[model samples]
Structures are given as C-alpha cells and as structure tokens.
Target: MTFFTFVTRGLTRRPVRTGLTIVGIAIGIAAVVGLVGISRGFETSWQTGMKSRGTDIVVSNMGRGLTPKPFSATVVERITPLPHVAETCALLVDLISVEKADMMIVSARQWGGFSWKNLKIVSGRLPNDAAERAVVLGKTAAEVLGKKVGDTLQLETEELAVVGIVDGGAVVEDGSVILSLPLLQEITGNQGKINIVDLRVTPRTTKEELTRLCAQITGLVPEARAVIAGDHIRDSQAYRMISAMSWGTSLLAVLVGVLGVMNTMLMTVFERTQEICVLLAIGWKRSRIVRMVLWESALLGFLGGVGGVLIGVVGVQLLVTTPAIRGLLEPELNPQFLVMAVAIAVVVGVVSGVYPAWRSSRLTPSHALHG
Candidate 1:
C-alpha cells in the first residue's frame, strides 16, 4: 500500500484512540484561536469606541490617572487656535452616586464636534442645546437605570431630564450617561473648569506629531495632558494585561496537548515494532521507514488540527453571542488569524511526529522477528 493509504488505514484501525487524540488537539487549538480572536476583538472594539467619539486627541488631567481633574476652560480656547487643530471641546466626567445606584457621568458641550459614527438614537430625540439639566441615556445605561427618554434622572447633586437616548454601539459608552457640556459643568460645580479637552486634528497629523503637539500644549498648561486616540495610556495598559493573560493561558494548553500527541505517537511506534522490522527486512530503506512513520504522524496531526480549527470557530461564535463574555472581550475572527492558526497546527504536527519516526526507523528487522 502507498504511504498515504497505509497511514489512513492505520488511523481508521484505531478509531477511538485517534478520535480522543483529535479531541485533545482540538481543545488546544480552540484555546489558542479563541484567545487570539478575543485579543483582536478587544483592539477593534477599543478603536471603534474611540472613533465613535470623533475626537482625534483626548486631553485629560494627568492627575492620579483615574480621577478626573478639572483644567481651566481657557485651555480649550487656547488649543482651538493652534495650527492643525480643527476643533476643541471641553468634557466633564464624574462619578454620580444616586440612591442605590452609582454610575459614571460623561457630560460634554454640544459646541465641540461629536462623531455620530457609532451613535444611534434608538427611541428619543437628541437633547436640546438650550435646555439646562437635560441628559441623554446610553442604551445600556437606560436599561440598567430603568430610565427612558422623557424620564427624569437625578445625577450627582442635580436632577436632569432625559431628553434623548444614545447608543454608542459599544458596551463602555452604552453604560454612560451623556448630557450637554454646559449642564454637566454646572452640576459638577466646575463651571469654568473642564475635565477633558477633546480635540479633532487635521487628518494628516500622525500620532507622534499629535503627541508632540500635545506635549507643547501641556507645557502651555501643566495640569492638562494629551492622549492620542487608539493610544490612550490607561486603555493600552488594559489591553496589554488582557493580551498577556490570554496568550499565556493558551500556550500552556497547547503545551499539554503537544505532550499528549507525543505520547500517542510513541505508543503507536511500539505497537508497530514488528511491522517496522519486516519493512526493513524487505529492503525498505531506513529513510523510507522514517518517512512512512513521519507521514502517519503528520496525518494524525493534520486531522487533529482540522478538528481544532473547527472547534475554535464554534467557540468563538458562541462567545461573541454571550452578553457577559462578549462585554469582557470582543473577538474578531480575522482571516489572517485563521490562516496563521492553520499553519501553526501543521507545523506542530510535523514537529510532534519527528522523534517517533526516528525511533521506528532505527529498529532492525532480524531483532524484531527473533523477539
């Protein structure tokens, strides 16, 4: 029988063992693929969330990194006139503790541009620029608070009217309450002080250039710090943590699976010892024996890899549809990631087969028959 045919028949002969091996490999592959997909998904969601704001650079108080510190409103006026700056708006972010409910409050001025990229009004009109104490509820925020358009919600120390509902198409934003900049400023008691300066720069400005510009802006005003979109320091830290944890766990799983593959191949080699010896006695070259064994190992590996890819795809799909898990990590199944996963699986198969193939090739036919 040809090498391929022999390998195929051998795998069929031990269906239960092969199936278990494939399952083990598939679990490992699925872990790797799902982690990678989630990582990429996080990146996509972060970028998408930032882009939805339509601001090129986000300037916030460089205080303790988490708390919002108010900067002078003049800072916004000053940055707006700078070269390459398209527009600038003041932002106020604060934590509002309501009766039995605490939530983040984001209030921005209507004067600054808003990117409607991902924002959709689901069930109400936009907040009026002229109305004081008016607020817009994010979809999630509305759901959680059990508040809807036309409902009155009290935030911080002030009660505000919910005029509109805004959905940012993301979990983070969907959980925030948006109000007019002026109203937000008044409620926070930082009338002339802004917590963030959102800027829209010219499209030609690179992140590096924006950083440098922001540095200069910070120099102009020490309390303010500029952060580029997609490179928010806090967000970057979060991404790194998620990526590291995901990959580390995946690598461990893969290592265990590889060990299983090694064990299976070794057992197969011992069971076929007599057959290997006969092949050598028939004048089959050692190289040919090695190739045959290696090919069989490879066939097993390929089958396992295929099974893994299938399992991983299904797992990712299930994860995306799950609300709690989906919020934690967004997984984008990019084509490139899929291709890389397959390639890695193939390489893993080849590597796992090498040692067993060598041992099979070294057996002497006479010694085997005598035993």
Candidate 2:
C-alpha cells in the first residue's frame, strides 16, 4: 500500500481516540476564533461609525478606560482655523445606566454641528432646538431600551422626550443614546466639558495636508492628541488591553490542545509498536516511520481546525444576541483570521507529533518481532 494509505489506515484503526483528540484541538481553536473576532469587531465598529459620520480626524484625551477624558469644550477654538479644517464638532461621551443596571453609551453632540448631518431619521424628527430637553435613540438602542419616539426616557435626575429614532449606518453608532451636548453636560455635571472632537476636512485636502493638520492640531492643543479617525481605536489603551487579553487567553487554550494531541499520538505509538517493528524489519526507513506519525497528527489538526471554525461561528452568533452585547457591536468572522486559525492548528499538529514520532523511530525490529 502507498504511504498515504498506510497513514489513513492507522488513524482509522481507533476511531474513538482519534475523534476525541480532534475534539480537544477543536475547542482550543474555537476560543481563538470567537474571542479574537469579537475584539477585532469592536475596533472595526468604531472606525465604521466615524467614517459614516463624515469625520476624517479625531481629537481626544485618551485615557485608560474605554472612554476618553473630559476636556474643556473651548479646545475646539484652537482647531477650527488651521488650514483644511472644514468643521469641528465637540462631543461629550459617557457610559451610564439608562435603566437599572443596564449601562449604555450616551453620545451627546454639539447642536447644529456637522456631526448631526449624517443621522438619518427613521421616524419622528430631530429635536426642535439645542435647549429642548429631548433625545434620539438609534434603532438598536430603542429596541434595547424599549422606548418609542414619544416616550419619556430618564437620564439621571432629568427626563428627556424621545423625539426621533435614527439609523446611524454603523453598529457602534446605532447602539448609542444620542442627545444635545449641552443637555448631557448639564445632567452629568460636566458643563462646558467635552471629551471628544470630530473633525471634517475640506474636500481639497490632500494626504500630506491632512498629516500636517493633525500635527498642527496636536501642537496647538498640547493636552489632546489628534489622529485620523480610522487609527483612533488602534492607538487607544483599551484596544491594546483587549487585544492582549484575547491573544493571551487563546494561547492558553492552544497549549491545552497541543498537550492533548501529544498524549493521543504517544498512546497510538505505544499501541502500534509491533506494527512499526514489522515495517522496520521489512527495510522501511526510520525516517519513513517518523513521517507516518507526523502525517497522522497533522491530519487530525486539519480536521479539528475546520470543526473549530464552525463552532466559533455559532458561538459568536449566540454571544451577540445576549442583552449585554445586543447593541454594542456586530461580531463577524473575518476571512483572513479564519485562514490564519487553520494555519496555526496545522503547526500545532506538527509540533504535537514530534515526541511521538521520535519514540516510534526508536522501536527496534528484533525486540518487536518476539514481543
């Protein structure tokens, strides 16, 4: 029989053990796929929301927490006149309980700013004036908060009328509770203090000019940093922590898979000692025996990876549907990440087989023939 056929036969000889090994590796890979996907998805959602709002650059005092630190709203004055800056919108962003224990994002924008232009109303209309005690809910937030256009929503000590329901065109945007900056500031005791500034550049702005503008903004406002909207999340402390935790947890899971695969391969080698000895006696090279064991483990890893991807997909779907995650962001399994996961699994398989393959090669023909 051919070498490939020989490897297949060995694996099939004990289906139950092989199946269990595949399952162990599969669970490991599934954790990598699900956790990493959600973390990456969070970054993408914020970037997409910035783009949808026509924001080209962001200025903020980034902090350890997910939200930026509050800065004086007057900082916008330092940014409006530098070349290529078309408009600037100051915002006060916070996370607080809209209901009992249901903490949610509250996005309060400067009234009549360009930031308000992109909000497409699905029902009702925009608040009449900046001083009006009213708010708008993104479609997802409305569903989560269980409020309609005419409902009175409580915000700390104040109650604001919900005047409109909007579709913000991005997951992060659609999951927010939106209102006028002044109103949020008054209720949250952050009057005249805003945390984020979204900038829109003139149509004629070039890449070099944009870079210059960012540097200029940072230079003028020493307390805050300026970055292109897309790069904002990548540069944040919270994103880095999320990324590190995701990979660290995944690595632990992968190590478990490696140990499981190693144990299974070792057991298989021990059980098939006589068969390996017969091959050696018939002039099969020790290298060939080593290759046989390696091939079997690699095949197991390949199957596990495929199964893991499927499990990860289902897990992410269920996770996103929970109340805590329902409107935060949409998690998607990226093609590039999926391919990388399978590659990792294949490497894991080869590494796992090394010790077992070496042990198989150490079996002598004479010793095995008698036993």
Candidate 3:
C-alpha cells in the first residue's frame, strides 16, 4: 500500500477515538472563527456606515467606555466654519430600552445635516423639522418594534409619532432608532448635549492637509479629539475591548484543542507500538515510521479544520440572525481567515505528534516486538 493510504488507514482503524479528537479540535476552531468574525464585523459595519454617509472625520470624546461621552452640541458650529470643513453634524448616541428591544442604539442627528441623508425613506416621510415632536424608524427597527408610519412610540417619558420607516443601507444604521437631535435631547433630559460629530472635508484635500486639520480641530476643542474615519475603530477604546475579549476567549478554546490533540496522539502511539515494530522489522526505516505517525496526526488536524470552518461560518450566520444581535453588524467573513484556520490546524497536528513520533522512532524493533 502507498504511504499516504497507509497513514489514512491507521487513522481509520480506531474511528471513534479519531472522530472525537477531530471534533474537539473543530469546536475550538469554530469558537475562534465565530468570535473573531463578529468582532471584526462590528468594527467594519460602523466604519462603513460612517463612510456611506460621507463622513471624513469623527470628532468625539472617546474614553474608556464603548460609547463616547456626551458633549455640547455647539461643537459642530465651531467645527463647521473651520478651513477644509465643508459640512458638519453632531449626534447624540445612547443605548436604552425601547419598546420590545431591551437595549437599542438611538441616533439623534442635527436637523438638516448631511448625516440625515443616509436614510432613504421606503415609506412615509421624515419629521417636518428639528422640533416636530416626530421620529423616523429604520426599516429593521420597525420590524423589531412592530411599528409603522403614523404609530406613536414612547421615548423615555415622552410619546412621539413615527412618521417614516427608512432603509439605512448599513446594518448598524438600519437597526438603530433615529430621530431629530432636539426631540431626543428633550426626552432623554440631555438638552443641548451630543456625543459625536461627523465632518466632511472640502474636495481635493491632501492626506497631510487632513492630518493638520485634525490637529487643528483638537486644538480648537481641547476636550474632543478628531480622528480620520478610516482609523476610527482602530483607535476606539470599545473596539479594542471587543477585540481583546474575542481573542482572549479564542485562546482558551485553542488551548483546549491542543491538549486534546496531544492526548489522542499519545494514545495512538501507545496502541500502535507492535504494528510500528513490525514495519521497522520489514525494513521500514526509523525515519519512515516517525513520518507515518506525524502524517496520521496531521491528517486528523486537516479534517478537523475543514469541519471547523463550516461550523464556524454556520454558527456566526445563525447567531447574527438572532434578535439580540440582529441588524447590529454584518458578520465579516474573509477568505484569508479560512486559509489561516486550516494552516493553523495542520501546524497543530504536526506539533502535537512530535513527542509521539519521537517515542516511536526510539523504539528498537526487538524491544517493541517483545514488549
């Protein structure tokens, strides 16, 4: 029989143990893929949402929390008149229990700002003006809260009319509760307060010019920082937290898989001693015997990796559809992640098999045969 076939048959000989080992590794890999994918997706979705709305720079008081702390809405006026700044808008972003949603994103944008233009009304109409005591619902938010045009919804203690259902184009935007800045402020008791400012630069602004402009903005507003939109999430405290947690959990899962693979390989080495001795007696070199053991473990890892990718993809897909996470962010699945996972699995297999391979290679044919 061929070398590859021989390696595979040895794995197949004890199907139950091999299957369990593969499954253990697969579960670990799936956790890594799913958690990492969602965290990345969350960051990407916010970045894309801002980009779609033509925001070139984000001005906020980003701190240790996931949400930037509220600041005076007047910051937008100071920023708009600055050089290279063509347009600007301020937003009050908050998380609150809204109707059926225990927690939801509430985005209240400055009246008549470009930020409002991101939503395309599929039905109904936007609030007449900043003080209209009305609201527009994102299409997904409408579905979740079971609201439609002309329905009245409660905001804190104030009741507001829902005048429109909008398609926000991005997942995070569509899942949000959007309203005028003035009304939300009145209801939430955050009068004249805002958390974020979006800015768009004039045409043909060079990269160096943009950097200077950011410095200028921060210089103008001592309490706030201006970050280019592209690097927004990379610098956010919240994104860093999300990434750290995702990777930390994934590391634990991978460690479990490493131990499992090592155990399976060591057991196989013990059980296959006599078979290895027979091969050595028949002129199979010690190196060849070691190669066979290593190949067997590597095969197990490869199979586990394939299974893991599928499970991870499916798990994330299902998870994002659940109400708790729905419309929050699109799961970011990259081709590179799949390739990396498979490669890591193969490496894990080879590493796990090293001691087993060494032990097999050290066994003299006569000693193993007699033992």
Candidate 4:
C-alpha cells in the first residue's frame, strides 16, 4: 500500500480512540483561541472608545491611588481658557441605582466642546441644550431597564426624560446612561461643581508636549491634576488581574488536551509495533519509519486544530448574541488567530509523536516477526 493509504488505514483501525483524542486536543485549542480573542477584543474596544472621545488631555482630582478624585467647579473654569486649548468639557461619573438596578451615570456639559465619534442617536433626538434635563440611554441599558424613548426615569434627586436612544456600537457605552452636566449635578447634589475635564489640544500638540502642559496645569491648579485617558492607567490594575486569570485558565485547558494527544500517540505506537517490525524486515529504514509515525501524529494534530478553530468561531457567535455575557468581553475571530491556532496544533502534534516514533523505530525486525 502507498504511504497515504497506509496512514489512512491506520487511522481507521481504531476510530473511537482516534476520534476521542482529536476531541480532547480540540477542546484545549478552542479554549486558548477563545480566551485570547476575547481579551484582545476588550483591549481594542477600550482603546477605540477612548480615541473616539477626541480628548487630548484629561484633568481630574487626585484621589487615593489611581481612583479619581472629584474636582471643584472653580478648577474647571480656570483651565477652560488655557493656552492652546480649543474647547473643554466636564464629565461626572457616579454609580447610581435606578429602580433597584445598578447603573453607571455619566453627566457631561453642553457645548463645553468635547466630542464623541461613536455616540450616535438612533431614535428620538439629543437634548435641546446642555442645560436640559433630558437624558440619552444606551441601547443595552435601555433594554435592561425596560425603558424606551419618552420614558421618565426617576433618580435620587430628579427625574430625567429619555430624549434619545444611543447606539455607540461599542460594548462599554452600550451599558451607560449619558445626561447633561447641569442635570447630573442636580441629581448628585454637586451643583456648580465639576469632576473631570476633557480638553482638546491644538494640532501641533504631541502627547509628550501635552504631558508637559498638563504638569504645568497641575502646578497652576493645586486642587486638580491632569491625566492621559488613553493610557488606561485608571484601570490597569483591574485589567491585569483579569488578563492573568483568563490566560491561566486557558493554559490549563490546553495542557490537559496536549496530554490526551500524547497518550493517544503513545498507544498507537505500541499497537503498531509488529507492523513497524514488518516494514523494517522489508528494508524500510529507521528514518522513514520515524517520519511516517511523526506524520500521522502531525496529521491528527492538524485536524484537531481545525476542529477547534471552528468550534471557537461558534463560541464567539454565541457570546456576542448572549445578553448576559455581552459587553463583559467580546471575542473577535480574526485570520491571524485562526492561523496561529492551526500552526500551534501542528507543532504540538509533532512534539507529542517524538517519543512514540522513537520507540517504534527502535524495535528489531526479529522480535517483531516472532511476536
């Protein structure tokens, strides 16, 4: 029989064992691919969202550690007319419970001049002006609250009329409620006070130059400090913890799968001992014998990888559509991730086959014929 025919027949010899081994490896590969994809997607989404804000510099009050401190309204007013500053707006964030459901509250000024590229009004319309008590609800948040445009939402201190439904196409924004600065201040009991400032610098301003300018601003205003929002410094610690947990869990799954493949390859080598001996007896060189065994293992690995990638794609689809898991982390299945998964599977197959292939090649023809 030709080499291809022999390999095909060998796999067919024990269909159940081969199938189970393939599945084991596939589960591991799928875990790795899915986790990596989700993590990358979250990081990308965060960066993109920050970029959409179009704020070159962020100024906030210095609080404990990296947590944000509330800045006074006076501080916000002082920096509005700083050199090279085209426009500035104050943003206030709070954790509020609405109808017993916890939600994030975001309040920003009208025409205080910052812009969001992705914040689009899908229904109704934006508030008439910043001073208006109207609010915009993110699509997901609206669904969760069982609310729609024209509904009145009662908060701690005031009632807000839902003027529009926001569809930012981003997971983070989809879970927030945006309102006018004046209205937010009234609800939070912080009237005439600002918490954060988003500043847009001139075209000539570089990030480094902006940093220096921020330092100068901080010196000028002792009550407030400047920060770079895109740096992710605010959530770095939290993200690191989350990333480490994800990677650890994924690695463990992949390791279990690799062990399954290795065990299967080893057993296959033992089962084919006499056949290998016959090949040696017929003048098949040790090198060729080893190559053939290795090839079989590699093929199994490749198949497992392909199956795993397919499964991962399905998992991603489910994740995106599932409401409970949506926005927590979204998995992006890209060509690069698929290619890498397949390549890694092939490599794992070769490595797993090495010991089994070596053992088979070492068998003597006389011993095999006698058996």
Which candidate number has the best TM-score?
2
Which candidate comes out best when scored by lDDT?
2
Q: Could you tell me the lDDT of residue 60 within candidate 1?
A: 75
Ranking by TM-score: 2, 3, 4, 1
lDDT of 2 by residue, 120-222 (tens): 9999988998999999998988888888999989999999999999999988888888999999999999998999999999998998888898999999998
The whole-model lDDT of each prediction reads: 0.71, 0.89, 0.86, 0.73
Q: Give stretches of model 2 more than 4 Å off.
A: none
TM-score per candidate, in order?
A: 0.76, 0.96, 0.95, 0.79
Taking all chains together, the TM-score of candidate 4 against the true structure is 0.79
Model 3 over residues 244-324: C-alpha lDDT tens digits?
999899878877877888898888888888888888888899999889989988988888888888999999999987777
Q: Which scores higher on lDDT, 3 or 4? A: 3
Query: Model 1 reaches what TM-score against the true structure?
Result: 0.76
lDDT of 4 at 350: 84
Native-to-model Cα distance after best TM-score fit, residue 242 in candidate 4, in Å: 1.3
Candidate 4 per-residue lDDT over residues 1-371, each given as its tens digit: 78877666766789999899888878878887788777766666555545666767777763542225566777767787777777776777554566635444354553444554357888998788877877887787778677799999777767889988888666656666777777777777877777677777888877687888788778878877776666543444555565676778777876776787778878987888888888899999999888887888888888889998988788877876564545433466789988998888888888888888888878898866585
Q: What is the lDDT of candidate 3?
A: 0.86
Residue ranges of candidate 4 with Cα displaced over 4 Å: 1-6, 57-85, 93-111, 116-118, 128-133, 154-159, 181-197, 206-235, 327-329
Candidate 1: stretches off by over 4 Å: 59-78, 90-118, 129-162, 167-177, 180-197, 203-228, 233-235, 325-329
